[model samples]
Target: MKFLLPIFAALLLSLTTVNARAAEHGTAEEAIALINKTAAYLIDEGPERTFFEVSNPRGRFTYRDLYVVIYDLQGRIMAHGMTPRLVGLNAMEYRDDDDKQFVREMIERAAKGQTGPVDYKWVHPQTQRLHAKSAYFRQVGLYVITAGIYK
Candidate 1:
């Protein structure tokens, strides 16, 4: 009975640690909310202003492990909240570690007037390691606004 108790305690501790780590990162709901907010901002403030704000590393569009990224129909980066240097770059040919052209897929989905999540592998900014991620995106005018959470 004593051995079983210790095993149960260890299992409980492991579960708690996993939950804590998950809480430290962003969630799917947060990503969707950020995407909606970015889209609304873009519609109201226009692309030039919106893009500048979205590209600001310390902007409101960035929080936790999530950030907004705007792309045109052709997969050109319009703004990137986490990496402003990515702005104005064409990401159509960019691929994940698994050779998945996620940017190109995102462009295709957005062009079809789709609004949902796209699962792929990407380098996590905080960890600097490739991790599974799911980005929620929505098509707004000529651009697609996205925000992702690491899973």
Candidate 2:
């Protein structure tokens, strides 16, 4: 029965692999849907209301896990998600390569009227922990949503 036991274990491993793959696909789909929803809201509400109105509530509700930013065409931060201290702050002053790159990429894509896909390995400012984040940018708009999962 040793041979039978080995075959059964292999089957179990295969099933686990399939389940993991399905879960990943499901997560990607959900991420895409979230970006789309945020984009639609931005389009309908416009930047003024989006940044001033929606941000306050979301920041109040899920303040810790989310960091929202709205930038103008000139790459100036107009609003900050949870941290009000960051409002009117300039990301251009950042010295770190990863942080700068993240900002640059978001602006570049936003200019093209595109929303970037889920970006992983983002770093938190206060905690300095590695984070998995999704960045959504809409062109010439009032807001960008960045959701970070702590690692």
lDDT of each: 0.89, 0.55
The most accurate candidate by TM-score is 1
- What TM-score do all the candidates reach, one by one? 0.85, 0.53
Provide the lDDT at 15 for model 2: 100
Indicate which candidate wins on lDDT: 1
Query: Candidate 2 lDDT, tens digit per residue, 49-117?
Result: 666643563643233344456665556676666565666766644433354456666766766767665
**Model 1 global lDDT (CA atoms, 0 to 1):** 0.89
The regions of model 1 sitting more than 4 angstroms off are 1-21
TM-score of 1: 0.85
